[model samples]
Target chain A: MSSSKLHPLYKQLLRAFTSRPSDLKTSGRLLAELKVVLIETGLIFPQTDYSTQDLVIAREILEIGAFWSIRTKAMPSFDRYFSQLQTFYNDYSSILPHSEREFPIRGLNLIRLLIQNRIADFHTTLESLPLPADELIANPFIRHPVNLERWLMEGSYSKVWNAREEAPAEEYKFFVDSLMGTIRNEIASCEEAAYESLPLKDAATLLFFRSQSEVLDFAKQRGWLIDLTRGVITFTQKGEEKLEIPKEKLIANNLAYARELEQIV
Target chain B: MADVEMKDAKSKSDAKDDIATPPLSPVSEIKSNVTLIERAVSTLEPRFTIRVLRSLTALRKRLDDKALCDAISEIYPQDSQVRSSLLSWLPASPTQDESMEVDPSPSPKTPSETVPETEIYFRLLILHHLLASPSTYSEAINLANETVQKIQSLNRRSLDPIAARVWFALERAYELGGELSDARHLFLAAQRTASLRHDDETQASLINRLLRSYLHYSLYDQADKLISKTNFPTSAPNSQYARYHYYLGRIKAVQLDYTAAHTNLQQAIRRAPAPKLAPGFYQAVHKLFVVVELLMGDIPERSLFRHPVLEKALRGYFDIVKGELPVSYSVRTGSLSQFQTTLSAHAVSFESDRTYSLVARLRQNVIKTGIRRLSLSYSRISLRDICVKLHLDSEEDAEYIVGKAIRDGVIEGRIVHEKGWMECGGQKTGYGPEVSEMFSRRIGYCLELHNQSVKAMRYPLNAHRKDIVDAEGAREREKELAKGIQKGEIDEEDAMGGDF
Candidate 1:
């Protein structure tokens, strides 16, 4: 629980985290121990009373925990670490030395929101960033998700498909890949609505799949009819139901307005 | 000769009255205002309380330790504990010359019965005075905390108006001390109590205070949650309504619900005080309003900037609005570099106004404008040329951006991916479903407006009888006045000028 005790645990965490082919189990265990030490030192919540050295270490530990959560795909834990880091990043920003991990972690959070399709929250997070918009866009870490959000809004799935190669960090690829999965599903639905059938090669290219087998697998999952001889996939057309206008509700609403006007007169 | 003249004037003034009344000081003036508030409480007339509050702005500048101390000592009896506590909050006066002469003369008929309203008013003044200096902000915060507790414990109905004022001071103290979030629970608890007690004024004030606290930390989610959980009292004053609408506008704008945000900002502007009276609030509201308007793709009226209140505060916003003019010119001409330059130039102000993200979203409009121009000028364009003209990073990005523009119906176009060129089609000129949809929307809006206007019309009770009676009385008075004038009993100047 003491600073001397936390130092070794943190160093171990860093080693486990940075090791090529990171051992999630060892880093996870180390993070748990580090959290306990942080709670004991009263550095977990980042009160003003804690020494600056302790606060810095506590912040770094949480940052590593955030990255670990992403690596292990434990999104809820990532959210917890993010909320905890918020205090250190914001409240203690004046006292502590700036952490290089801040923007990368924040960018990852933004990308995580985008992957989850929480576009409103993505923007809220962007607005909450301390830096100005231009500076944030200039940060490659922040720019990746911001650009992805714009591309997503524009219905430009191909650009998002290409963005996976340009992720700012290795860990960012995890979220970017998930984002691509969402985009593929979107592109699949659009293809379904637009066409009755397409050749396998063209479908593969349209869906950004490098191999025909991946398109077939995705097609099978979507319940499309595939022909082996012609190598064509057919989309099942939904029935074209006639639009039914709610006549009664419209009339009732008009009557109510008329009645209210009558009373006013 | 000057000495002789001074003696003559002094003797002449001395002979005017045997006992000279002390000259009126700020302390005496404030003491009288406190008495007026007491009279208001006793009579249940709130207008007096409002009058006292109106004078507080001017009186705030004249406050000092001696003035507050003098006022408190005069208001409370020598044996009163409230007097001592109130005096303790103010620093002891540094000057002794005036105190030595005035210390011994406590008002002879000091009332043991001190109204809690007066005590809270004194605390409010002292809180504002303390807040004037950064060094004393902590003390102000402490005093604010103690005052809130006292208001809660006293639970007096007469203290409701003063309690609202005290809460304003309390919020200021905490905000200026840079510990606004720490007082969130305090505001929440007090708000609950105020609502339960049916204290609408304090409840309204506390809700605003709580929203502001949440917003100060950029806790928009919590602010939105607080808003949904609590119902703002419909009977709250216009000022409170203005504040509520302003905060709602801010929350909605950040959430990208531009339509709702625009309506809320308009309501805020409508409910706000006259611009000259509260220029800061007026400017703040309009700053958000202009940004929301731009985001909604409507240009604010050119006359808006000519208003005396807005001309100075909206200079930066005017530039941004001006940059938007070309977008509306032919719907095809927009300068991305101009938008970027204007945005970066006003970036600091926009950031200060918290509209940077919303303004930055205008870049999309710039791109759309570029695409519209490209579609108009060319029957077909290669992706490379599009990239070069639009300053895009690459052909692929240009293809995607142009495809997006086509899908969004910003232009009638299709991309030939294999050839890497876009085919532009002519604009649709015939009547379409979209035209009918627009007409229906307009018709619905008109009907709704008519219905609302009808509902908003108020009819006073027995209005015809009252009008008749008023008319008869006015006629009788005019007849009497005319007779008097004919008899030369009234002077022409008095007859016409005085009445007018």
Candidate 2:
């Protein structure tokens, strides 16, 4: 805020500062981001406006992101920030952002949103979204150069008078999650383009996707994954179907393949 | 102005000792000799430039080849203060000639008699700097062991404002090296020095350090004992006192006296007032509180314990000790993380298969002193049991380890823990456990050191009467001051005098 050409760290603070009317290029783009955030998480609610009381929760989450972005951007070690990404998931948003009041965009809420979108045929399971691995290098989770920098200057803080970097483990986790989420989206988009209409649902995670049957089962527990058991489960048929962009399209591609063939049979 | 100078002397620990004696050490002589050698090796003996090359030379020659370091330790300066201060930083490897690497212990300014005021703490600080670097453990342990042994050789009282600092540094080294007993002993010893200076600010600062070492060593009794010694918020202002309470909170928290732990820890946070106390402490404490709360499931946050800082402080402190943070910053700000990392690294590099030999001393002390009141204390756990656990070659090695434990006050019985359990000195009344636990170790130690047990044991419980008398005397004195205030004999400004 003090200097123009805001630092990446200040971007979090800036994002939090302008919570009501978020600067997401467009509200549509912002919702797209939010929808993805929701899909990955299992928020308790399908939708909660970040206009009133929820705004405070959103701001805190954003501030926490900014704080870690500041620290992560300064570190030099990639592994260190990666390790911290696990902690970020557990500490910051694994549970709902409920100090006194619950924010709807918590872990389960996000998961639920994805489930709803997937049911309605939203874009695709976010995991399948295309993302650039290089973009991930900038994602705080992978950007360990900042941590290495901090490590390099471990004794630097004391040798000179300077403000210590904030290291709230919880807040740090939030930053890692957001960055990783962004990276995941980036990678998902890339993989989506690469694996267009694959037989498997998690074609983006193609290497790890189990047989078509296993993917269907895993999708059942995690409704965010589509169930294309035999494509007979489709709500629309053939080219007449207009997809509404599901929050999660995990099972769709695999399930669609299985279902499309089964429907023909 | 002269009055101001004399008044400041009230808190200067060295003022009294400086009037008396001044004797430099054999180590200092060796140090200066080493300086000469370093000067020969490279013109700049103490520079990082010189050190890198010298450390390489020493490494090539392998200084651990023989008793070179032990000889160097003995050959250090002759003045007790200089010798002890320098020795306190000597490497633990008796074979390591650390001076061979560093040479002439560079003072920021050259050393001189009437010891140029600045150079007084210079060596202790350098030792601290070495410890704070992300060095290996063998080097750190070697450094730490030498540090304390050398400091012991000095007349601590004679150390300037620097002496208190020297002791503080020594305590940190001891703590990091896992010499908990020695650390607590030195910490208490520092407290005594702080009290002698009558400098409450310095005393209070040291008190917090002492309290943390007490917790780490699991010396809850001593920490608890300390609480009754001074009133809360009296030693320093609310902020400083809050830190003190936070440390005590940590002790209680670690001890698992949840009710009391919460009460005090919360008050600590409330009183700390400053956020820079490092919220990590609050977070750690809060997490612990949350843990206890979850464990209890329905327990309410007790009053006076609602705000916790110890957990946060602990998180911060642990990361520091673990070398999760960089060593450079910790060196200046005074985190002992570098020392622990170095010590651990030392154990791994040289000793191999064991990275905890130094820490065994803390266990050894507990085994010897048997201070079970500290909670889950090793002292009550039995030596035979520990021998089996630690895998000593024989009971003698176990006993040797226990002797170190006795030094930690971690265990009980001096002779039983000491190697020569059979030998009886002139005043040895029955070295065996004939009496209660309280009188055993403290009494035996007094007799061993003083040889006048009859009078010493005559008041075995505590010098409580003296303590009461002191308190009563203070209350009576304060009443007179109150009366003076009432009578307008003392001005309001006078009553509220003294800067914090």
Candidate 3:
């Protein structure tokens, strides 16, 4: 398909998404957090959920996937409402990192693990109740209520699995495969963040700070990346003194980016 | 925060520093890794550029002992930063008032002998400094010779036939600095060292360099014998020996032997297409080829320098040589008149017609495009030093002329050479070149030199003018050579551009 139609729509969408149009329930403070999640949810289910509905909220969270506590701190007045919301998000909370935190990719995998445990507990609860199968489906809301099992394949729930095979001929195999795939996928996404790439000059500055400090352990624990000279840093002797100069490291670009430039993958 | 700026690749500053300076031949590093990291830190400016250099020096010298020689078989020089630090270490003259008020203190030079490393380092530092200082070449040579006699392992440029001292004096010979016999002896001495070394590429390269120096005085026989003997790999014989072919080829062209010239020229072109050619060689090759092709009547219709065969050769050499050429050219103050006057004194007068046209072309294409820039700057050292070394005239006359040339932007100034005076940035005018501008300036230099030498043959005591026949015509003729010294390695006695 031609990209002529593509540019304007994306341009319009970006502007609309960035602009928070209206306040939501519990004011707009919580709405931004909700907005972020809805964005991740919408991106995964762009076909399933219409972009016109409650999307500005989701786009914010989808953009960075920063935690709700960080968002709450960014908006201080609605503390109690976020406090209530935090419990549903967290368990056994004293404002925890939450066994199931938000969608920062890393936290998503943790949340997946927590949800799996919660699902197991719900199954156990049903087993202990001894409820008849018809009775479970007998309630007005339970009577074939929106068979979300189909949505599971496309919605946010299923996207937690990697883009690779989520289905299997063998039930046991698919479970293990998708779980591992999801973990790897999240790690890959988080690794691509800007914070991870320490520019050489910046790294040098950071290293200088490290050298000045007596505490090497503290600096190392910070997980800060240290960039080496990247290439040969030789001195060209000029008159009274020699001066040092940097040689930048050059690496081949990712195949996908090169494809865009040269129009070949 | 200090703004980090990349130094211009061919800054006049860098060129002037390298010009006439002996090889730094710095001692090997005692430790490479720490110094590399330290240099990185210093440059990245944890504090400042100079401060880091100073700190690196201290760290490098913070060694325990040289007695660990058995473990450390080779000794590299301390961090390069030490040289800069040592400059500050120069002892200042004691003030009478301070001297009278001072409590008794021990001299820092105490037992300077016991510290072998310090002694060697300081002595070498003095030599290095003197060599680079525009006016201090003679002083540096003296200090280096004085120190060389006492050292064990020498890391000098191995300038035999002309002992290091002799070469130093000869360079100053233009200023009447050293005795001619002494200079010859030193040059020969440098040649002797090459003979002693095994017939390796490095040894061959050094031999070639020395031979080039010999050829400067038209020592054809010696240069020929030296080239023939080098056991270089035939494909590339004699140290970086592509030159061997060029020299032979040049001789053939000059002899009007087209067949021999063609064969030699072809060989030289093939071998030196990308060989580390000097600026002179590049221009010389083009010169030789033009004469050969013209003499052979092969390219009567083709431009001399622009002929395909020669153009490729010129481009190949210049691509590498330009890197070494000065980023800019500087004209000595009062240099234009001196050049004209100097020319008028000679029979081969530079009539305004040719110079005017060329100067106009240069102004239009080079200066406007910034391919070349003209600057005027003060000279602490000038050609006066050369005059003094050669015993040509009084220090005053040489200085006066050099000073005037500097003002007129004719010749460039030397390092804190004590040959001239200082002036403000705008006050001390000079000329510099971009790659393209170099061509114009070089042409200008050739014409002026030609004029100067022709005068020498008349009544001006041109004892050396015999070496410079028709230098003025060389520049216009060497136009095909526009491509030869781009990387800037090519330096010729008279770098004449040929219009191939």
Candidate 4:
């Protein structure tokens, strides 16, 4: 719990975190121990007074934990790390040196929100950024997701698919892949609604799938019938339900309006 | 010129009188305000307290260390510790005449018992005074922290109104000291207590404080979460409602919900104090309102720019709204270069107003106008020519922009992708379902307005009783007139003339 004791544990965490191939098991254990030590020293929420060196080490440890959590795909733990790091990032920002990993983590959080389809939360996060929009866009890490969001809104699926190669970080590819999956499903639904039948090659191209087999498998999952004789996929339309108008409610609403108008007059 | 000279001479004499009787009038005013607050507590009516608060703005300008010190000593008993502690926050008086006369003054004291409401009120005044100077900001923060703790511990229902004011001063102190987030937990805790006690005034003030702190840091998500988790009491005063609506409008606007933002901003404007009374708030709300309206693809009314309080502050926004400047004229004419020049020219002001992002989004509107104009002028235009005319970067960008314009219904055209040309469609006649739907919407709005007005109409209390009394009086008068006519004692011409 003391500062001297924390130094060794932090060093060990750093080693485990930086080792080739990323020793997740050992580093995870070291991270938990370091977190306990940091919390005991009042460096997490930092209620008590702490020395500058201790605060810096504590912040770096949490930042590493955040990256490690994301690499391991433990999203809840990553979120916890993010919340803890906020105090250091915002409150003590004047005292501490800027961390290099701040923007990347923030960028990752934005992509995480996008992958979850929480567009409102994504914009809220963007608005909370300390930098201006142009400055944010100038950063390659933040620009990737911002461009993806704009392209997604514009219904330019091809731009998003091309954005996969332009991701700034390796972890970004994971979220981008999931986003592509959602986009593919959206495109599939639109294709079904707009088309009667399409050739397998065209469908594959439209869905951003390179292989014909992938398109066929996806088409099968969507309940489309594939005909080998014509080399095409056919969508069968379901029975259209009758549209029932709420006639009584409409009449009652209008009648109420009329009654109120008469009283006003 | 003679009238102006007389007015200037009168003001000069008034200034001399102010210097001569430094603490007399202001101290007496404070004493009267304290008496009013006491009466409010006894009557269980918050309006008297609000009246005292309303005069605080004028009283605050006259307050100095000497005046406040004298006022506190006069209000408190000879041996009151609250008196000494409140006096300690003020700087020692320098003038020998003022200090010599302030001590040992034979001012009448009401009671030895000091109410917590008066104590909190004094603290609020002292906090505001300390916040006026940058040097005493830390001291003000300390006082605010101590006062908050004292109020929480007292837990009296009568303290709610003054406590709300104390919280406002607390927010100001923390904000001035640049440590607003440090006091966030305090506000959150106080708000929880206020809500549990059902103290609507304090709760409303605390909510606005917390919202302001969150927004200062640009933490929209937290502010939005706080909004969702808490219910804003409708019984709160109009000032609190205006602040609530303004914060809500900011959040909604950033979230790209322009229609909701517009409505909330309009409510804020309606509920806000007169423009001269709160010019900063009036200007801030209008600035955001105009931006929201533009984002919604509607021009704000020209009259809005002519408001005296807003005319200077909203000059940049006015140029963007009305195309008054040559650059903005170019913007209205769909020149991309001109729009860029105007945006960069006023970018700093826009950034400071926190509307930079929203205004930047107007680029699409500019491009849409350009495309609409181009479509109207030329039935068939190649993508290359469109790009050259619009100052677009490339033919491909133009194609994509045109495609999006068509999809968004900004233009009626189809993109011939193979030939890389946009083929415009003929304009349709006005007789269609769209026109009918528009008419129906207008009718519905008018009916709804009529219904709302009828509901909101107010009638005098027990009005029918007055009508009954009038009818009885009329009957009596009729009987008297009949009796007089029957007795032949009334002249018909005289009665008719009098009646006419």
Q: Where is model 3 more than 4 Å wrong at Cα?
A: A1-265, B1-133, B143-181, B187-190, B197-202, B226-239, B254-280, B300-500
RMSD of 2: 34.7
Model 1 ranges with Cα > 4 A deviation: A1-11, A32-58, A94-96, A132-134, A155-159, A188-203, A219-245, A258-265, B1-36, B43-51, B58-114, B132-139, B178-182, B331-334, B368-500
Q: Over the full model, what C-alpha lDDT does candidate 1 score relative to the true structure?
A: 0.80
Q: Model 2: how many Å of interface RMSD? A: 34.7
**lDDT tens digits by residue: candidate 4, A1-265:** 4777799999898988888887999999999888788777778898777888888899899989988988888889989999898899887888888988888888988888887878788888888887976687689989988888776654456777877878798778667667888888766765555345777877787788889889878988999999978888877865654555556755776786678668777
- Please list the residue runs of candidate 4 whose C-alpha ends up more than 4 Å from where it truly belongs after superposition: A1-58, A69-77, A132-134, A182-207, A220-244, A251-265, B1-35, B65-123, B146-150, B153-158, B319-334, B364-500
Model 3 chain A scores worst on lDDT over the 10 consecutive residues at A145-154
Interface C-alpha root-mean-square deviation of candidate 3:
41.2
User: What is the DockQ of the complex in model 3?
Assistant: 0.00
Evaluate model 4 with DockQ and give the value: 0.26
Candidate 2 C-alpha error for residue B251, in Å: 4.7
Q: Give the per-residue lDDT digits (tens) of candidate 1, residues B1-500.
A: 76567546644544442234346566788888888988988877776787888777766755666678888877777666567667777765553223233222122233565577887888889998887667788989888888888888888877887888889998898888888878898999999999999998899999999989887778787788999999999767788999999999999888888889998989999999889889999999999998888776677899999899999889988988777676545433345666778988988888888788888886676556667777888999998988887666677567657766665567776666556687888776566545655665676677777866766676754778989999999999999999999999998789899899
Please identify which of the two predictions, 3 or 4, would achieve the higher lDDT against the true structure: 4
Better of 1 and 2 by lDDT: 1
- Using DockQ as the measure, which candidate wins? 4
Error of 3 at A218 (Å): 99
Error of 3 at A44 (Å): 99
Error of 4 at A150 (Å): 3.0
Tens digit of per-residue lDDT, candidate 2, span B1-500: 75457335532533343344245232243244344433433432223222322232222221221223343335444332444334444444443334334433333232332232222333443445454433333455555445444434443332323343444555566556666564555556656755765655446666777776655433455576787795443535464577676666555544435467666767776775445445655554454443333222222233313345443333322332333122222212222334345444444331221112212112222222222221133224444654454334455344334433333333333333222231211233443333333453454454445533333444423569889999999999889988988999898786788311
